[model samples]
Target: MQDEKLNPSDETPKPEAGGAEPEFDYIDAEELDRLKAERDEFRDKFMRALADAENSRKRSERDRREAEQYGGSRLARDLLPVHDNLRRALEAISDEQRAQSAALIEGVELTLRELHNVFGKHGITLISPQPGDQFDPQIHQAMFEAPVPGTVAGTVLQCMADGFMLHDRLLRPAQVGVSSNVG
Candidate 1:
C-alpha cells in the first residue's frame, strides 16, 4: 500500500506541537463561513430556549404562591356571616338576659373566640374602622351617606359591619355610613 495525496478539503488536522493552534487548511473559506453561520444560529436558538424556560419557571412559581395564599377565599367569605351573627347575638344580650343565661352566653363567647383564633391562624384579619376615621373606599364600602353633626364629609359616620382581609388581598370592605356633611 502507498500513501495517497488528499485534497485540501479532505485533510485531517495534524497533532499539535508546542501548544500551536490546529490548522483549518482542510476547509475552504465558504465552507468555514457556512459552519460559522450555522454555529451562530444554533447559539441564538439555545439562548432563546434558555430564556423561555426561565420565564416559564418564574410564572409557574408565581401561580403556585398565589394559589397557596388566596385559595381559601370562598370559604373565608362564607364564614363571615356566621361571625357577624355571633357578634350580633352577644351584643344584643341585655344585663338581665346575660344574668339569666350566663352559661349560654359564655358558650357563645367561647365559640366566637375559637372562630377568631381560626381566622387569625389562616391570615384572616379584621378591618374595623371607627366612627370619625377617614373613610377609605379601598377598604370601606359606603352603605349610606348621611349628614351628621360636628363631622366633615367623607368621614365614617358609623361602621355598620366590619370588613376582612386575607393576606394582601381584601376579602370584604367594611360596610359603613359616611358623613355627607358639607365642608
Candidate 2:
C-alpha cells in the first residue's frame, strides 16, 4: 500500500551530482563513419532486393497474360485439318449435285461459315494466296518450285493449303508452289 524509493545501485548509470555533464559514451568519428556506411549498405541491399521482387512480379503477370492469350494455339492447330476437310467436301460437290441436295449443301455451308466466324472471333485468320501473287517466305511454305514461262521468279504459282494466324503469331504457313523464271 506504500510507495518504496528505488536504491541508487539499482538505477542505470547517470550524470553524477557534479555540475559537469557525464561524458556520454564518446563514439569516435571512425566508428560513427563505419556504422553509417554499414547502414547505407544495408539500405542499398534492401532496395535492390525490393526492386528484384517487383520485377519478378511484373514478369509473372506478363507471362500469365500471354499464356491466357495464346493457350489455345495447340488445339487450334490440331483442328485445322477438320476445317480443310470440310472446305474440300463442299468444293467436291458439283453445282448440279449441290442443287439436287439443297438442304444438305445449305447445312454444310452454314456450318462452315459458322466455323469461320468462330475462328475470326478467336483471332484466327487465314493466309490464302491466290495464283500469281508474290511469294512471302514468312507466311508461305514452298512445297515445290517450277520453271514457268512469263511468270516472275519467286511468285506464288499456287496455294495448296492456306495458313492461319493466331493473333500476331503464325499458327501455320500456307503450303504453296513457287515459280522460277524460264527462257
Top lDDT model: 1
- Provide the overall lDDT of each model, using Cα atoms, as 2-decimal numbers: 0.95, 0.92
Tell me the lDDT of model 1 at 91: 93
Candidate 1 runs further than 4 Å off:
1-25
List model 2 lDDT by residue over 88-183, tens digit each. Answer: 999899989987999998998998899899899888998999999989989999999999898989999988899999999999999999998753
Candidate 2 TM-score, C-alpha based: 0.83
- Top candidate (TM-score): 1
Residues 47-69, model 1: lDDT tens digits: 99999999999999999999998
- C-alpha-based local distance difference test score of model 1: 0.95
